[model samples]
Target: MANPGYCVKNNIYETWKNWEAVNLEGMKEIGYALSGCNQRFLNFVVFEGEKVSVNNFYFIAHPYNLELPVLCRVFRIQPYNPEMELGRTGPLAGKKRRKADYGKKLEYIIGFAEILGYYDKGGKWRQMEVAPRPWDSVYEPTEDSLRQFLLCQQFAQNALVVEIGKVRGTSIPVYLDLNAIARTHTFVAGMTRSGKSSFIINLVRASSNLKPRPRFVIFDRRGEYGALMKYGAEVIPYTEFMPAITNPDVIVGKLELKRTEKEVVLSAVRMLIEEGESINREALYKKAEKVAETKASDKTRTKTLENIKWALDNKGAFIDREKKPLDIISQIRKTPITVVDYSVDTDIEAQQRTATHIINHIKDYAMAQRSKGDFACIIAVEEAQYLAPEKGAEVKESSAQGEAKAAFIEAISQAGGYNVGLIVMTQRPAYVAKSVISQCNSVVCFRLKSGNDQEAIMNYTEYGSERLAEYLPGLADHEAMLWGMAIPTPFPLIAEMDVKEYPQKAAAFAKQAWERMEEKVEG
Candidate 1:
């Protein structure tokens, strides 16, 4: 009745029509692919009435030539006109009429885009080997298509996604893969008040919604993360959250004891632990006195004891007997988020020692959990520069700080396998330890004003080229460039989501204090 070849042709047409209905609908034609296009990059000339922009996603519509449209991101744009010369003082420009029209109608844009591959029938992004044909129509993807293009569909399907913010210039939400982030640490850097802390807070809040939620241990140097309590976090003051004293070297480092003094202190701590006594300031001092009496001359013993007493008086707040000791590890396991607030403590060395103790304990816990095939937790370090300064960067860094830095470095390199993630944030990227920063697999960079800091970030991320670096200083507050394993794209400019203001107790204003003093004098 009907020719078999004709029937096959009709079936092919019907199939293409169905695919076009789903894939081509709502795509706006903006340009045509130019001749210089390649597998990795696309060159296009924008239509006279249409527009294109940097960082926007577009697709080449060539259904017959390719099974699916190829997605690309425009990264560069320039104005061109064949009739007009751009050079002002050249002989060719001078010969042309001075009043010649350079009107909008005569100008068009030349767009350069990076080929970001195409989705296969299984909804996976696969590398595209074939380039688009010259003169093929280029269209701006619809919002839904753009979302499909930018997200890792497999990760999204598992609900292992957290919304960090919206894509810049669009309302489309951008999500990070939680599993990727947990497997590979993230580094966040920016100048103060550049929304670095706010971004971290948002990430923590979003992560709380996932199934089989991972715990958060936040070392909040400035006490800012207390607001997380509203989301079911336990904010423990630094003085009360005492980790078990498993190592005497921690105390020796904190005190910065001399050679003889350090040995005596270690002996004392060992004796206290072996006897099952609480490792408080009083017990430690008594044990040290006994060790000194047995080993040192009267003059040397006197000096060592006096030095130990002085150091303890100033930096041994954690070992104070009056404060009730809470087991930090137990809290970490039970709580969804545990924040150690250090706003009340001004001694930096003491803070370093405390952080070292807690980190060591967490590391051990994570390793144990890893053996059981359980994911442990994420540790967020705020003001990381103070605790993990670059080697020899701070002349005043004590042994305590050095130990803290070492703990962070080890955690960054080894903890991912244990399902422990580190979120290392700093206002001074140049001051943070290079080894620690280099280990982070994802980067969320905010506004940075210093050249050294920008250079440091450039070395860490794959997409941090000179052109991208130019955008750093001008980034608006809460705007950041996100790249690496956590996100699907190589890099994307995102407007960080707004977070609720946290509670911060304001200091007494100078004027208010002075007026109060004057009133008291009048009284």
Candidate 2:
């Protein structure tokens, strides 16, 4: 007996003819369901003259059932030729068969798809309880039908939605739930130059345009996001916006002060606060010298004074002596987008301290805002691996860096209650803290070349199967797989990111600078 999975030749021809007669204009009869159908997977064989590609969406319809059609995505395709396979191993093992013998008569295409469930009457995707029977007709849905099934129309005009890109090959706009992203946090990871940064820039622009816009505090490590100033963003240098010291012990911990030195520094900070003096580098150094003179021996005082002076001189990127500290809370409240440009500061330890300090302040402020009504803000951290490195990784991290990582992880875990969101973007997910990535409810992944990095992403998302990881290294630029609460469905979808034009490229700026230097030489 013939296999039950395949339809008879005549039956397939008749099915195609009947489908055409029905005049379903855009819907095309492409194939028939085959034997391996199940609740989670569908196997089908394509008819002659029809084509299907990986990642394409198709619908399977039952002959007698009137339920909504099941939507599935093609992930694998192979050529099927049972006769040719047998002929090669049978009598024709040594003899070469003429190409004209079989022609295309025995050739067929097989497709393996993952069932993406079907949209219910209310337009929500639900799991499939039953699989389509063998020989059932498979259809390539029209663009309109696919869009409607994906619920693209509902979010098109919604103000709270932010359009990141389109469904990979279609014009259907893919939107993310802004509220969900802000409250639950998001993780965006990819290799360098894989369009992760561009996606974030677009997100910032979209979020800024919304009414009662949530504040955006972007820690721009590479100084790239300054172009957002054209979109009404306030780009401030890191040195100008450092926060004042609130706790002496915290500062001492950040400085990694020695046992004897820690007391002198702590006493100095306390004296500065008590005497109503601004705790800048010079004032702190002066107060520390006085404390060392009063409590230490000559040998101890010399070492203590030298340590304090060195710390003030070298690790003072976030310290200010004369000028009043900028009110960061007021700045975040007033500006729609605040970019803290850290490109100029090369002190890694100071950067960590600054990040930790600012995060603590934001957390406190966010809590107060949430008490009144709906208030939201996003803290987008670029190059997050440096600030939130995994504990005891290859690179030895400082105590201050550990504090920064802790603060970020804490913020991510408790952000929903405070309405403060965290967007952690990194080129090296392997180096970043797993806790930070795991807490984020949404993820946008671009091409990742490292197996370790791919494995890191796999730990957090449900779609991170071995087969799915195989696709990560090959994803094109500007294309990303989006999943989790921010998206419309639980099944991940690849998006072609839509980024707005910004200022001149970095290369152009460098060329301009070289030309200026040449002119100076000529003069």
Best lDDT among the predictions, by candidate number: 2
Task: For residues 1-523, write the lDDT of model 1, one tens digit per residue.
Answer: 3332233334433443343312755688888888987777789888886878776778875444444777777778899765555663333654774544544357688998877666666554567777777988888888776655554333323325666778877776666766666678889899988888788787778667666576888888777786687878988887676544447886777667887788888999999889998788888999999999877788788988888898888977656545545777789778989988888868676677778778777787788877687557778889888878886675274557667888878878888877788888898899888888888888888889899999888876666666555567877888887877777554454555556553344456789989999999999
Off by over 4 Å in 2: 1-26, 62-66, 80-107, 121-124, 152-159, 245-320, 394-397, 462-467, 502-505, 508-523
Please, what is the whole-model Cα lDDT of each candidate in the order they appear? 0.74, 0.75
lDDT of 2 by residue, 1-523 (tens): 3321122223333433332111134588899889878888889999888999887788876334445677788888999655556555423632555453453577789989888776554545577888778888889988877765665223212225667789989998787777677777889999988997788888877666555566788998888887788888998887666555557876786676877788999998899889887777778888888888887888778977888788767766456645565667788878889998888777676677778878888887788777685566788899898888887662354546667878888888886677788889999898888988888888999999898899888876556655566467878999898887777656788898897844223655777999989999999
Q: Pick the candidate with the highest TM-score.
A: 2
Q: In candidate 1, what residue range of length 10 has the lowest lDDT sum?
A: 3-12
Give me the displacement of residue 434 in model 1, in angstroms: 3.9
Model 2: weakest 10-residue lDDT segment is 3-12
In model 1, where do residues sit more than 4 Å from their true spots? 1-22, 33-38, 61-64, 80-106, 128-136, 156-159, 209-211, 243-324, 371-375, 392-395, 448-455, 462-467, 470-474, 488-498, 501-523
TM-score per model over all chains = 0.75, 0.80
Measured by C-alpha RMSD in angstroms, how accurate is candidate 2?
Answer: 9.5
Roughly what TM-score does model 1 have, to 2 decimal places? Answer: 0.75
